[model samples]
Target: MKDSLLWDLSDIATNETFPQLIADTKKRIDKIVTWRKHLSPQMEKKQFVKMLNEIEDLKSVIACIYDYPALKELTDRTDIKAREMKATALDIVIAAEESVRFIDHWLQGKDVVGPEKLNDEQAEVLFSIVPEHKHLLWRSRELALHTLSDVEERIILQKDLQLSEPLLDLRRIIESEQQYKIKLDGEKKTKVIRTQAELSKLTTDANPKNRESAYRVLFKEYEKNLDKYFIIYQAIAKDWSSVANLRGYNEPISMRNRANDLPDELIDLLYSVCSENLGIFHNFFELKANLLKIPKLRRFDLYAPLKDSDKTKYSFAEALDLVIDTFEGFDKDFADKAKRVVAEGHIDSHPSPKKAPGAFCATIHPKITPYVFLNFTGKTRDVFTLAHELGHAVHSLYSSVNPYSGQNPTLPLAETASTFAELLLFDRMMQLVDTETQQKLLMERLADSYATIMRQINFSMFEKEAFALFAKGTNPEDVSSRYYQNLLAHFGDSVDVDQIFSYEWAYIPHFVNSPFYVYAYAFGELLALSLFAMYKDSGEVAVNKLKKILTFGRTAYPIEMLQELDISLQDRDFWMHGFSVINNWQKNVQNIFSHERI
Candidate 1:
């Protein structure tokens, strides 16, 4: 159930004080960056340690202000004290960067502090900000924004290096049509699909005829203009590879794992399991075809309407009520926060052309911790998306309370609470509905779970093989062809291979926006589902343990975090529990189909 109490930001009383706070904070931080350049690019190791301390001190102050309730929300005093506090902290960050710049300046050969017998506190400065974001917000920038300027240094040190240039360019490609051309066949078409968000309306169309055509028109444009987009991808790949080479990582992907601090064994274990279990998805597809009484299940049919047209269509308000009511059943604390967010206007439920595709929660800095920019289109699917994104907001809200903290958990860990909440709500929703609706709901879950499991794992295999082929000096055509061939092998005979093949990868936003990121969905979903099984068996005790992990901040690493729920990353049987849950649903779907044939 979704919490009805979520509010839109426009309704929040941020008033004059909040705006000033944001303004002053930006200015203060900007100056700090400027001052740091006094030190040469290469400071002695000793001087670098001194600069790190100054940063830790600034983070402590920022954390204090963030912990303050008025700064977290709106000021009751209207005194603009929040503004001053924000600005001062921003100034400190600027100073921290200046210290880095000073180190940078000294690297070119200049005098600086020595490591002569520094105390334990001085040694711990960098670690102090590890789980907290106060310094990372800048350190990552210092490494990336200065990329071309300090190429050798960047490649060597920054496995954790964040690059906004590629992402910024991607955003431009999505929003700006004139910047990127769209072509069809051997000819360039005047009718270009402007952005990825535009494709969402196209891709999710109800009619299969419409969906097939929409995808064709949309992908034809991408396929023909491959050189342009491929060039952008090439640059990103080349840069990442170069940086990885510099960092002494075996590959760009290895560098990513290093930066994320993710265990290679865990990743390998996930792939090994998923690869062996692909038949699960194949069975799911066959079951869907049976229940729908169709001869074969095509890719477009995957997201088709689960129930007939006469079934209930949820209004946004009704959906909100259901979501709110569902979550309240879990506990009152969850219910109260949800109610306030809705009532106070913390959500932007409407979707627009200018807004980005997909939904995410940005803490927007701990001092002014607010969730921004949601795009909803009133589908029952949208209801789940709302629950999912709100879960992100809830997780972020908890993490933001401390200020100067990392936004939330590590990537895989971040999805745990959000997906778990959805399962909790979905399960209860199933219990309340009639038997027919229950069947439909179970079908939806089976479809969704298969996608989370096989679709993503198949994608991971595609990336690995594609990149491996590329490493052997393969051309774009070879890579594309190879990908299409493997996709057919994965999707099998159930889908319209000719129409949806090559262009399918074109629409995957994750491939363009976040590389090697698809696996996390399967990883998180199965992990959460397995944990949900425990809850069903143990009830409230299980729920309490999971909640503790969510609120633990990033103090715990990924493995340690899972321990809170007593879920094991090491045990194959743990994942098998969730797989069996889907398998059980498949049996039900199969039985329905068997009867329908009569």
Candidate 2:
């Protein structure tokens, strides 16, 4: 039977079918090309505005048209039609971008400058007409050194689609479609699981043996296919490094840093602070081990539930109510925006065969109420994931006032609302539990923090080294050895790191799909934690501050926007504030244990 919580996709289709949409997209691209041919650097302000508007319209149309097929593929990877349609949609987007490439190249030329930086002659030109596009123009000028000619850029995009993209698709297919088998306690027969999401839940199973079995099953599968995984990853890394080199980026991660509009110093500081604070998590692991009444923790036991942990299985409906009510407690608008996702049938709320692992909220355009994908399994973490994805939906809705170009925040700030929502949910969950369960909840929150903040940083650090090694033509075994060393460094002596855990990196999709994307989690969590502290102290004022930050979207530099709220990203102290919160929680767990012993 289809679950009641299953999302309704009837609203996804429009009057035009996929074929018609593709045809319309082609016509749109051709129109843009014709429009571009008629453009001139010496054009009037009105003409410039018209050209910008046309490009913006094309972008919006592409986003709206591509969302359905892309979403369908995530829901069911086996749907060959969806896959084809998505590729077609992507190709059309690339074609449209290729056609309009000259606009940016022209803007980056001497004829155009930022509003503040414009000369008398430049002021007379069309670029000074739109103040809103000043940042876009200024940014182009700043990156003019790396901005290739339209032809070169086109070649790179085409090569990425033809070469790098297929490798990514192959990795996804292999990782997502593989089946995992494990025998549970008291079961003579083995069980087969289709999706990694199903298998992952067992990693936190209350039973220690079940957790061990789950890890063994997961790593064994990856170990068997290590060579293929290595080839795919190595190729992707090489491609990424080559492109970075071609673009004159100092390092592979510098490309991502530039795209995120953050400085290399800032990222280096973030990573340095995180690496220095490794002992915090090491202490946390020891605390967790003591709580579990074990001598030491295995990597598999990192998320293991405590003996007295709340094992209450929440229904989907129940989880939805908890999340909604939690949001409502903070602000009615936030709650309503989150509820809109559910009301519009935008949430796919259950796990199924071939469904993608993990949860995400897809914002197609400002007008669309983002669709959320989930593999809910009634665990407490599942409830938090519900809140997390809904939080992303609310953030998108809040930023709807922005043009398509400015609607999405850069990767680091993107997690602010989502992580803050988890904080709200965590606080509410605390209120509903007894003191003992509250301690358990605190422990779980710590585990989540370790996963969200430290683990992601670890991934980012590994990527930095892995990318460098691959560029030097490092072997797969050496790469795996490097990854294992990273694991050992991350866990230290507080937890046991096994050989099979080296295969764990292959299981991470972000490394394949978007390199260096994991660090954003750490950045967002730390930022959100600091903001949440302000909320606890100032209440409605802090809420309004967050709402304002969400609305800023990509309108200003993230650092400037944050500075407007008295949040500074310039120093190590700001990052330390977040770790301090985690440290206090660890101390509280110790206090709870101390009190019990007396």
| lDDT, candidate 2, 1-598, per-residue tens | 2334666655655435767767877887887777655555466667778878878878877886678877787878898887777777777877887777766666666332222233335634554677666666677777877777666787897898799989988988888767899999878999998877789899989999999999999989988888889899988888888888898999989999989989888999999989998898898888878878889998878888777667879888888888899999999999999988888888898888888777998887777778899999998889999999999999999988887787889999999899999999998987888888888788888888888889999999999988888877787688889999999988889999888888887888898889998898899999898888778878999999899999877777888888998878886787887888788888887788778841
User: Per-residue alpha-carbon lDDT of model 1 for 469-588, expressed as tens digits?
Assistant: 655666667767877887788877666466445755655656656667788888888878887787788888876776676675555556766765676787888887777777777787
In candidate 2, position 321 carries an lDDT of 86
Off by over 4 Å in 2: 1-12, 15-21, 72-84, 110-125, 169-202, 206-210, 220-228, 315-318, 342-345, 350-357, 375-378
Error of 1 at 424 (Å): 1.4
- C-alpha lDDT score of every prediction, in listed order: 0.60, 0.83
Quote each prediction's TM-score. Answer: 0.74, 0.88
Error of 1 at 269 (Å): 0.9
Best by TM-score: 2
Return the TM-score for candidate 2, rounded to 2 decimals. 0.88
